[model samples]
Target: MNIKSIILGVLFLFMSGQIALAQSTGTEREITELSKKKWEWMADKNADSLAELFHDKAKFVHMGGTWGKDREVDIIRSGGIHYKKAEIHEVMVEVMGETAILWNRITLLAVVGGNEVSNPFMVTEVYVKQNDTWKLGDLTFSKLLTRD
Candidate 1:
């Protein structure tokens, strides 16, 4: 292929990716916003809100252990691990039919066992739509070595 053709092909591919990203519709935006609010709710230790959002069989995976929705809500309510703040650096959401998956890069500051700690994590959240509402099905935090 000629140099000009190669360049044009590369540009086309790049623009196609951009268009796909730009085509994220209202549902995607809504899910993204909901994820952001979830982080805020965590920081505030608003277990009531979280309880409502979490599905009945929701699972939460942490660095320490994994548990179901009730335990997760109780932990938050009782301040077992207080999510002080989540400095969200990046977030991406993809919707597939009635399911949405969201990934977030964050620096999380938290109080665990009465000690303040900070960590970088790539958090994955999965939500399933039931009726007209979306409920969080799973939330898993994967610790990242670099702060970035």
Candidate 2:
């Protein structure tokens, strides 16, 4: 290829990469905001909104056990496990194409089995973009020793 053509090709590739990076940044921000909203919904026990946000095949892992979407919604709706509040200390997100992974550190106040408890945890949330909307695919909570 001539020098001019080579230079143009390189410029085009560079611009494409820039655009992709920008899109990924935007996706990350969107996922972060969604995660915040999800916490609010969980605390409020808004099963309807949570149902819409969670994928059909979504799974949840807690200190006790792992379960599917329906069981999780049932627990929230029935007040078997209530997420009273979450004090988010930090959050970080990574977007990979259509999937995003979010890491959150927080102190959580929850009521389980008629008793209220507080604990610190590292929460991992995985979301997948399907049909232009992000849906929760997996969530796992790792209990932390210190409640700093």
Candidate 3:
């Protein structure tokens, strides 16, 4: 009711909002780390870890085709599409409520159909928080014009 009390209340609200923003940023960092782990798992062909990270309804899109979680897992498990290495140029992540979007620019070395290929791609990954844990909801890879 008083002027001093009003100003104090506003300051309190502002500080609380800042705290929430900091927490969200922390979550974004966690998702980023999880994403890096996913790339490692893919390179290692760790289907079990991938299965746990990917949501049951997750979808994957590639230059060749698009598929659901099961097919993607199978592809990685069977060496149909082996991710040999990823040279990450940059990664940016945004958190929106329970969903997070990650954008990554990288040079990917992969073995597909018995042929080894290296290409630059911009990958977008969508993650949704499920039971307080982030799970991959969708992933798409777009080929980049520049090889570097």
Error of 2 at 96 (Å): 1.9
Best by TM-score: 3
What does candidate 1's lDDT look like per residue over 1-148, in tens digits? 8999999999999999887766557778889899989989988999999999999999999999999999999999999999999999998888888999999999999999999999999999999999899999999999999996
Work out the TM-score per prediction.
0.83, 0.92, 0.96
Q: Distance from true position, residue 4, model 2, in Å?
A: 2.9
**Model 2's TM-score against the true structure:** 0.92
Candidate 1: which stretches are off by over 4 Å?
1-24
- Note each model's CA RMSD in angstroms: 6.1, 1.4, 1.0
- Measured with C-alpha atoms, the lDDT of residue 110 in candidate 1 is 98
lDDT of 2 by residue, 12-56 (tens): 999999999998888888998999999999999999999999999
lDDT of each: 0.94, 0.95, 0.96
